[model samples]
Target: MTNEQFIERLQQPNWSVSCKTEQQVDLVLQACRTAGISSDKREEIIKVLRLPIDIGFSKYFDTIEYAHNGAFKFLELENITSWFFDAIKKE
Candidate 1:
C-alpha cells in the first residue's frame, strides 16, 4: 500500500493487528476475546510478516495530523504511542 493509504489506515480508531504465526497473534486474539469483541467489529487485522526498523517514531508525529484539527485531547502523544507497542514487551 502507498504511504498515504498507510497513514490513513493508522488514523482509524480501531485495528486488530497480527504478527507472523499463530503463536505471535495469540495474545491479541485472546485480548479481543476477553473483551467480547466480535470479528465484525471496527478493527483491522493487518498481517505483516515483518516491519522495518527505520520506519520508526518519525512516521507517528505529523504536524498536519492534529495541527489545526482542534482535536487536541484525542491526539495526545502518550495515547497514540501506547497503542503501537506493548508496554510489558519493552520491559
Candidate 2:
C-alpha cells in the first residue's frame, strides 16, 4: 500500500487481527527493535508520525503491537526519519 494508504489505515483507532497485516506490522516493529532503537524512542517516533490523525493515537501505538513484537529492530533515527519522510512523500 502507498504511504497515504498506510497512514490512513494506521490512523484508525483499532485494528482487528488478520493474518496478512499482522505480519507487516510485526516486521516494522521487529525491525525497529533489532535496529536498537529504544522502546521509548521507537514510540516517540511512531507518535510523531501519528500526529496528523489523532494526537492521542501516538501515545498508545505500542499497546497494539503484535504479541511477540516488543520493539523495532536496528532502528536508527536517521534511517527512520528517512523512511518517515519518504513514506509521507509517497503518500
Q: Which one is best on TM-score?
A: 1
TM-score of each: 0.30, 0.26
Per-prediction tally of clashes: 1, 14
**Local distance difference test scores for all models:** 0.33, 0.36
What would the per-residue lDDT of candidate 2 be over residues 1-91, giving only the tens digit for each residue?
A: 5644655544443332211243333444443444332276544454434221211123245443322131222221111333433444554
Candidate 2: stretches off by over 4 Å: 18-25, 28-62, 65-91
Residue-wise lDDT of candidate 1 within 1-88, one digit each (tens)? 4434444444444333423344444444434344334242222332232321011111344211212222334433333334433532
User: What's model 2's TM-score?
Assistant: 0.26
> Looking at model 1, which ten-residue stretch has the lowest summed lDDT?
49-58
lDDT at residue 48 of model 2 (Cα atoms): 39
